[model samples]
Target: MQLEARKIGFYYKKNRWIFRDLNFTIDAGEIVGLIGPSGCGKTTFGRVLSGYEKPQEGTILLNETPLPKRGYQPVQLVYQHPEKAVNPKWRMEKTLHEGGEIDRELLEVLGIKQEWLSRWPNELSGGELQRFCVARALRSNTRFLIADEMTTMLDAITQSQIWHAVLDIVKQRNIGVLAISHEAALLKRICTRTLTIH
Candidate 1:
């Protein structure tokens, strides 16, 4: 499988393009890194690729077909802030199961505790909540993952652990990953190749 973005363009204001005429691709099982300075529209491009936002021009294709309009999306996005991703009203268990049946092995690998499932979003630490977010994005139907600064806030050890778990699952499932971050060393360490926006 491959995720391709062709001739993409986006803008928030008239005559102001966040990015335009962009093209990129990520083949299955590839770890691709996207790096640029802050406010460079890397996250916006990730959103467009994941179908969270429609590009003003061109198309995003998954293996030469348009992204699915309904049902579970093949492309999943795990954003930087897990707190903002979850529902404040729902318990951790509900949020985790939102995508589908929870995989026990995945939960264990992500270090998600059984007791944390009953707690609210505020009750868990950022790292714990991010584990749920990451696990939720790795559902059976997910073909590609857009990790937009996914672990920027975590401590070094926690970040390493999460990345290790994510990479393990990516290899096991052959899921393509578009990792967006400003850390050059991280990109060099994990990505097969890196693309710079500017």
Candidate 2:
């Protein structure tokens, strides 16, 4: 998977531009970090890259082509708030099942047992909830992942676990990861390549 953004412009409100004529390209087998001050549209940029939001101008091309808005395609997004990422009514199993049937091996890597899979989102703690969210995102078939502050709510140890897991996924799958965050220390810890936005 390859993502290229050129001269893109976006904004949430009047007279303020989040990204203007911004440009970057990430090839397969690479991890790109997007960092900036708060509300500089780092998450917004991640959304546009993942095809979850539209950019006011410019485009996000995957494999040298534009991505369709709807399909059984890949490229999953794990947002900052796990509460919003996973359905409150759905069980953990339901979350991982979206990409397909559950992979037993992945659960082991995430240090989660099958029992917890049946529980509702509310049943899990913040860290656990986000981990399950990661599990679900990994089940997708896409070769790229946009993680927008997905581990911000967790403790240091939990954050470490999530970051390592994500990096492991990237290495094993040979996929590109676009990790968005305002935490410079965290981004530097995981990203082989990083860029500051705005």
Candidate 3:
């Protein structure tokens, strides 16, 4: 399987492109890194790739076909801010299972305590909440993962834990990963190959 962005272009304001004519691709089980300075469209590209935003030009394709408009997304995106990604009203357990059945093994690998499931989002630290987000994104149907600084806010230990779990799953399931980050050291440590934008 492959996810390909062909000549993609996007912008918030009219005619002022954040990125233009960008092209990228990743194959199954490949961990690819995307590096760029802030405001250079690294996150925006991840958003477009994961179908969160429509590109002004070009196409995002999965195996040469367009991404599905509705239902479970094959390409999952886990961004930096776990707080923004979740629902404030729901408990962590509900949020965790919102996509599908809970995978207990996954929770264990991510170091999610069973007790935390009963607590609200605000009850957990950013690192703890991020573990849930990462687990949520790795559902069985997910073929590609777009991690936009997913562990950037966490401490080194937490970051290492999360990446280990993600990499294990990616390898076992043959899931492709696109890790978007500004940290060169982190990218060098985790990614098989790196791509720079701008």
Q: All candidates' TM-scores?
A: 0.98, 0.92, 0.98
Tens digits of lDDT, candidate 3, 93-133? 99999968967998998899999999999999999999999
Cα lDDT tens digits, model 1, 42-80, are 999999999999999999999999999998999999999
Model 3 Cα shift for residue 25 (angstroms): 0.7
| Candidate 3 residue spans exceeding 4 A from truth | none
Report the C-alpha lDDT of model 2 over 1-198, residue by residue, as the tens digit. 687887788877764878788888888778778888887778888887788777888988887788866765467788878888877887888777875775777777877767888899888888888888788777747678888888888888998987887787778888788888878888787788898876
> Which should have the higher lDDT, number 1 or number 3?
3
- Evaluated at residue 195, the lDDT of candidate 1 is 95
Task: Order the numbered candidates by TM-score, best leading.
Answer: 1, 3, 2
Q: Which regions of candidate 1 are displaced past 4 Å?
A: none
Candidate 1's TM-score? 0.98
Backbone steric clashes in candidate 1, count? 0
Ranking by lDDT: 3, 1, 2
Minimal lDDT window, size 10, model 3: 99-108
Per-candidate local distance difference test:
0.94, 0.80, 0.95
